[model samples]
Target: MNYFFVINARKFKQYLFIALAIIFSAAIVYSEQSNVSVFMNSEPSAIYSVQTEKKVIALTFDISWGDTRAEPILKILKDNDVKDATFFLSSPWSKSHPDIVSHIKSYGFEIGSHGNKFDNYSDLSDEEIRNEISTAHGILTELIGKEPNLIRLPNGDFDKRVLRIADDLGYSVIQWDTDSQDWLNKGVDTLVNRVVSKAHPGDIVLLHASDSSQQTHEALPDIIQQLRAKGYQFVSVSELIKQTQVETTPVEDQAMKQIH
Candidate 1:
């Protein structure tokens, strides 16, 4: 055997041990997100919900253009003792209301990025999208003192490129299975039913903490109780995403995930 190709017995055993260690470490990381290995596309797809059999769901609030309802909504969630909900904050909003931003964090509610400006993501070029997300992620992390790995696009508008860019930047795109339509000033009852009727285990329900969704405040109590009555467990969006490994595209979210 050529000397250069020869493997000493002790060195071969050492190499084998290192190879097994690396494989074990990879398994641990992959296990946390197993669905990624089998189902997620290379470009990454939005996670509308998890695939867990557990009767757990997530309630997410978008805080993009308005702060009029911030305190009130926080009070409502606090009163209900529902602190696990996710709040996606726009950089502009968080900049203006750092105190309120801090308050949300103090409650131990999960916070995610909502982009810096509420731009129509589908209309943005790749660089524009990067600017929007990077700007927001920086501001959020500054206030949060921790990196937030989840993002809900402004107006819920996104495309494959946006998802791919977000994946590259280390963010998982979040969407909702049940939208309250509260942004439309939909009546309280309408908002309530829109969510309660369509909700399922692993569902992500989108609401708003901004003034855009005035009816959300009115409809929230009922939404919480009714879903609870049905045996649904509330979780943060991060927790919801963490529950599943590979995310599959849902039939309905495909139609207008860009339209909010």
Candidate 2:
């Protein structure tokens, strides 16, 4: 019996050692895989918002196809003395309405590219994306007499490849954290609440000056008033980017992400 007991103890010790060795090997393999994943998933840079505590926000308007809506928005900005706004103008629209483009430029508002085609860049070929951005850049530069360094993809659609191409062309892709959804023309109250409630430091507010948005011009006054009452000051998108220490993360499609 004593001899059998000794044999059983020896077997138990051996099995325990094998189990610990297997666990250690698995841990090492997991650590290596994690390191590889971190390197492989590095994301390109895009400015959605900044990392700052200041009460600053950027009121950005996208004008893709419109002549009527922009003027009212411009007037509202001027009346409110809100000088730090950004307008991303599509090349085609700017070509058709040079006078309005001039008015926007006259206000000293920072102009950016809204891309030439109103299509999802993530769905386009890499070469096609490059052409769209470059074409828009040339047209806007001629109209504004200054090169546009910022861009907001049409429909706010983009992927990592699109970001890489834009970066190569000397553009910083600007995305918004707050969306007024005025394009829906839901109501002046809904638009106002969407913006005022979501307003935060270093926020980029997406509003449209395109004709599709019927209520943005009307909502602008209340939006500005409420934000100011909350202690948020408006800045140009470029200024907002400049004010923060930029950080990028690996996200699939976050251009249209809304702050909830």
Candidate 3:
């Protein structure tokens, strides 16, 4: 009887261990399904840095709610003869500024989704996250006649879930390599200095186009001139991604192109 009891106890422990292992594996799979998908080989990765022999970089702007600087900034780019940059436009922002969205495309600028609302993706349910991406994508396509294949999560907030949803929705999630920090209370001189000091070949620099982004606006021409002085040429986010040899198109672009 003693031996039988010991054997039973050992079997019980074994069963418990197996149960725990299953639970752990389930947790991992759940986590992956809940968040953004990961690329094992980094073949379809976003541009976090550039790899060109010459000095070149991409400048990107996030337009969430405000549009005070949108037209003027666009003019600035035109005056500077800047051909390319990426603008991540939120859904509501596009809804309110359809003409501006059109202008962005008409001027040959690349558009990227900034989600449906200006809310943080970190606070959204998985379904909500997918909805946000899809909604913004639809709105942008309807307005500009092209679905954005790139995205910069609102407030730059992202996680595995966010990435997975973006990937599933067919976007290459983009992040900045150089932050101008022009949205902060930094003085114009300091802001320019920070960017200039951090500027490098093949960098993706982040800026903003809201009312509070005046410092960024002020620093733009100077940054351009200085980077030019250093022999750097500006390119769009998509171009920069291509330069690095990473795939930038989301799966959605192909499908939408087919439909159109």
Candidate 4:
């Protein structure tokens, strides 16, 4: 009986060692996977390095609902010969403003998904998030005859799961580096100054074009003029991404830079 007990104890000790080794291996793998960084906002400055070598930036707008100033915004962009800009449109907004959508495409601008229902994506489940992104893609593609490859999370809220679903749906998530704060009812001059002071090559700028965004539209000309004076040429978000080197650093360590 003593001999049998000794043998069983030896076997138990071996099994314990094997279990510990497996647990340690799993922990290491989990740590590595969790360390992969993902962008959580829709601002480019959050994820990209601004290139100071050349004068270039992307002007982007988000249209969630209403058409109070869509036409005027379109006209201003057209009049200024601004061919490179991105518009992130909600499905409801697109449905109500078909003419504006047509004009946006006609002007040769990039279209991106703003979400299906204009709800905060952070509050949604993974399946709900996927559906929202996919539905918007389908609508925009039907309207413009080309599928949108980019998406901006509604209200600038996102998580790794949201980004993963977007990637699975064939969209690159975009976050802006510079926000015009036109949505906050700041004066036109104030908005212009904010953009100019933060302007750098390869920066992605955020703006709006709905009725409430008139201040933004009013500030557009000066923002462009001042940035141009500094030798900054505006491009679409897609073009801006193509123009810079993408640095894949951990999202936690990512710091917003003026010009990299």
Task: Highest lDDT: give the candidate number.
Answer: 2
Model 2, C-alpha of 184: deviation from truth (Å): 0.6
**Model 4 lDDT tens row, 158-230:** 6666766787788777777777778887688899999999877778888887676768778887887788788
Query: What lDDT tens digits, residue by residue, belong to model 3 across residues 50-74?
Result: 6667588888888876778888888
Task: Please give the CA lDDT of all the candidate structures.
Answer: 0.83, 0.88, 0.78, 0.77
Best by TM-score: 2
User: What is candidate 2's lDDT per residue for 133-250, written digit by digit as tens?
Assistant: 9999999999999899999888878788898899889998888877888898899999999899988899888999989999999999999998998888899988887887864545
The per-residue C-alpha lDDT of model 2 at residue 244 equals: 74
Of the pair 2 and 3, which is ahead by TM-score? 2
What does each candidate score in C-alpha RMSD? 10.6, 4.6, 10.3, 8.8
TM-score-wise, the better of 1 and 4 is 1
Steric collisions counted per model? 5, 0, 8, 8
- What's the lDDT for residue 20 in model 2? 96
What's the TM-score of every candidate structure? Answer: 0.80, 0.82, 0.76, 0.77
Error in Å for residue 213 of model 3 = 1.2
Q: Order of candidates by TM-score, top first? A: 2, 1, 4, 3
In angstroms, what RMSD does candidate 1 have relative to the true structure? 10.6
